[model samples]
Target: MFIEHPSQALNSLFRDKPYQGVNPEEAKFLFIGLDANYEAQIDAKPIFAKLREYHKDGAAFWRSHQVHHPFLLPQYSGDGRFYHRSFARIGFTPEHANQVSFIELLHLPTVGRSSLVPADLNEEHLSKLSQIVLAGTAQHIFVPQAVARLMHATGRFAWLLKRPSEQFGPLGILYRQQAKTVYSHLHFSVYGKFEARKINEATAIRSLISAGI
Candidate 1:
């Protein structure tokens, strides 16, 4: 089996916030996913691959490359073939990809051929994940409906999404808040009435945030 980011894996197990340098307030949108695409990430993008090699020396490399810090993230080199297009559904453009905030539920990239989210994800990984995500103060937070379900199954952070108030703001939106976060869910990466659905979701999110509900 091919070892992917052997060094990065070691670092994540120790680092509570593997993505340390990014500030939640700076992010326009906080995107949460189960993990990363290791094959496409390490094999195709030299800059991202640096996460593996650089973290071994401490967080220098990862911090340097963070998109929101001082630089903009160009579309990943292999974006057309590798990166998912669903982001466009949520108002993220190639330009916004740089300011794009990301939090992986599991920081460890799966080894060769292993699925991203296993049936039994490690509890330690899940625990820190809750902290990293909850600590963020982003105005908008999004995760796939699938991710909501999985988190619910574990009974951990599901409470974050349970309350939706009838008190909608100007644009006909409703929301529920948790600590520093204002979050909602959608069918991420599951294609359907692509343009229309995203417009609706984006509108609601904007309204909710603006209303401060």
Candidate 2:
């Protein structure tokens, strides 16, 4: 498996740019989803599927990949190169995924639209994922629309959503006290077959920064 989760300290999983406009060293928010689908494949494996020992959380192997492509912002007409330049005009760097902590609700791989996970996804799996998700100091968090609701329904991670969050129709804001993290839900997708709201920089950044992260 050709993975970039090198033991190289600077290029460690935590420092790897796994999303657009994310720089873990500088950003204070995290945007998580089901998994990644875009990037130069290794032996035809989705970047997230190539698990390496260096990955602190194999379930989140997507973070181990250097993601420079705009896999989430399809509304940009797949023209992030020029669209992101406008973001630079506003003083926010674009196409960097280091700052935004990257993780996935399911540390599994989506093959041709089929998401495959461990046959037996038990508490242990969730526990490991929870640890990785909480370990980050990022104050702002964004999860796919169904992720937060499912986490809330699971009766797990109540500690992360101890406070009543504000629900805005299809969106909501979950709060945790330990790090004062705010979790926002969004519908993100780049697949033409799947209809989902495209992720936007303005909304995501504003929510993250306004959360006081």
Candidate 3:
């Protein structure tokens, strides 16, 4: 696959600006989402600019960002509970959430509740995301089921999807690769109510732990 420079690719992911999480360079895991949800009209340029400024401080960026935007913190009373639980299941330490990066397939915020409107990204966007996925430092990548479906349907990401996947519990799928691992689970909002999958989730969690991810 033809690869573009990191900054150039990331620019596409965030609609012509490179936006990434705190300590992306050192992160061991990546939690990806479809897009941001907000009820107000937003201009993301300044937000990305602010993030770039805070991200320069590896020691303080995570906490500082959390202070300013408590909703982004995993411990907050939000969809992040899904991430917190999954991180624990993987035997990952929560105090080190800075070691995990958050990536969005689309950076634009949707009004009210988030939905799978686009379903998939265009070629230009997919090429950019592919560059990051192929070369980034995060060894473990997690995405919602909707995003996973998008990847599976897009030809640009076919190289990764072609690999056989292991069924992870009742509503998740896991793919192991030489350099990284990809796991797709139910959307965070629905995850809490999906009680029927609990037993299988435990077994899958143990399998994931054994995989050394």
Model 1: per-residue Cα lDDT at residue 59: 27
lDDT of each: 0.48, 0.43, 0.51
Ten-residue region with minimum lDDT total, candidate 1: 166-175
Q: TM-scores of all models?
A: 0.55, 0.50, 0.59
- The alpha-carbon lDDT assigned to residue 23 of candidate 3 equals 41
Give residue 143's error in model 2 in angstroms: 1.6
Scored by lDDT, model 2 comes in at 0.43
lDDT of 1 at 158: 54
- Full candidate order by lDDT, most accurate first: 3, 1, 2
Off by over 4 Å in 1: 1-17, 20-28, 44-100, 111-119, 132-136, 162-175, 178-182, 203-213
Candidate 3 Cα misplacement greater than 4 A, ranges: 1-20, 23-26, 41-61, 64-69, 72-95, 113-122, 162-164, 168-174, 191-193, 196-212
Tell me, by lDDT, which candidate is best: 3
Per-residue lDDT tens digits of candidate 2, residues 121-197? 34654675565456755656666555666566556666556343765333456766566355554344333543232
Error at 11, model 1, angstroms: 7.0
Model 2 misplaced regions, further than 4 Å: 1-27, 38-67, 70-97, 115-122, 133-135, 160-164, 167-171, 190-201, 207-212
